[model samples]
Target: MIKLIAIDLDDTLIAPDGHLPEENVTALAQAQEAGVQVVIATARGYAGTKRFHDQLGLTTPLIVSSGSNVIEGRSGEVLRRRFLPLPFAREVVAFAQAHQIALRVYVGNEVWNNLDYDPSNGRQRTVEKQVEQMAEALVEAPFQIFVKGNRESELILAQFGEAGEGYCCRHHVYSDGISELNILHPKSTKHDALAGLCAALDVPQEQVMALGDSKNDLGMIAWAGFGVAMSWASEAVRAAADWVVPADAQRLTSDPDAEVAEAVLRHVLHVAKDKKSS
Candidate 1:
């Protein structure tokens, strides 16, 4: 009965080396051929995730930036967007400055940063503009804010205790082991974005399958009726899922990132093929 599949990108659909495993890619294509709409939901921003959308040749709306933004894949048009209030954005900038760490601010299609580090995933960013004044640089509300450090997220949460009341303050680590803090509007969750897509497509909550392996994917995993958690996922995430799919054994596939493909093939393709013949 599933009509839509929401798969997280980095760990759920592709490997950590950023490789899109052939089996995973092929499974997605087969699902689409069954008349299912597939969406890539990720903590990655639009710029970071666009290439995968292009490669998949998907036309469904993409849920990006931990659900703060959703864009039409085919035309690259913003479908839904949520931005941090200007006041909060300014406060976040000030906090990062006081901590002496780099800050990356996402504003619409452009990414502004106070660091020399390239925020570009693959797309080229214009010459880095030094943000001298946090208040001035953040005149416009930002879509999201990113800060990286060794467990700096804990500090950020404690510091913003009273202020970040409703903000989605999640602490997670990058592939390289550097911990990161993601700051965004309270409503910026993949669950919220995926719900919106379901409303648009007239797909019921019980007919959606979400697969993920991390905290960022927690929202959608718990919200979807046919939720799937990677066996290697954190205890909290696995606890929230209806089913926990194992990370591939060397026999099914050696790749760790493409582990969720098993869930798709088993749950999605089997049902679709059954429906076709019946």
Candidate 2:
């Protein structure tokens, strides 16, 4: 039986502006009231995602920095962590330097970038504008403008290839056409985090329902018994999902939050309720 519901942040669960609609907020309350576990498995770190839990007034634990760590959202206690080996960490940094690509590293909740590539540099006026726009879009983001480098796409790929499961990488296309990449240790994936959460809660993967809308979310989507793709998810995301909500991104944005939340709630709650009834 399903005993837990894991939601992704970003475009899947939050508005484009980074705020949870009142309707979604209420739906979360209903899930909690039903005694079903409600939690988030996100790419965000503890500091970045805490506000979502707070906004919903939820006290459940959170899986942050992908699956690299599980934390107590309220107390900020790290319940568990999986870190990259020291050698691997150093290699990743070196690869970025070699390729002349910008790299952002997440060691715990802190982001470290190469000194020369810091986003604050006046030389990166174009990249800086994109960052500014994203910051405005999300209202809040985890990065704090650390070191930066020239675009080194080749080196970044090599790092991930050599690093293997030792680390994870996320590629983002900036509005300025610059590609920004982030790398973290292996455990920092939604799949691993979801597995970790299942173990902690004594819920089987077959009993979990996950919702997402991006490539980073692929692992968890495949890992869950029921994977939901948003209405506006990419074709790859839709292909990976067990079910697709007819509502795409535009529809979700234009439709009421309550409507979107209700669609998600019905599917997840049905799974949770039926397992118990069985």
| lDDT per residue (tens digit) for residues 208-238 in model 1 | 9999889888989999989998777889999
Q: Write down the RMSD of candidate 2 (Cα, Å).
A: 8.1
TM-scores for all predictions: 0.88, 0.74
Relative to the unseen true structure, what is the C-alpha lDDT of residue 98 in candidate 1, on a scale of 0 to 100?
74
List ranges where model 2 is wrong by over 4 Å: 95-103, 108-110, 116-150, 158-165, 172-178, 248-260, 269-278
Lowest summed lDDT window (length 10), candidate 1: 118-127
| lDDT (Cα, tens digit) per residue for candidate 2, span 135-238 | 12222222211223334544455545423655555665422445545555655677887787788779888877788777778888888888877766678888
Candidate 1 local lDDT, residue 21: 87
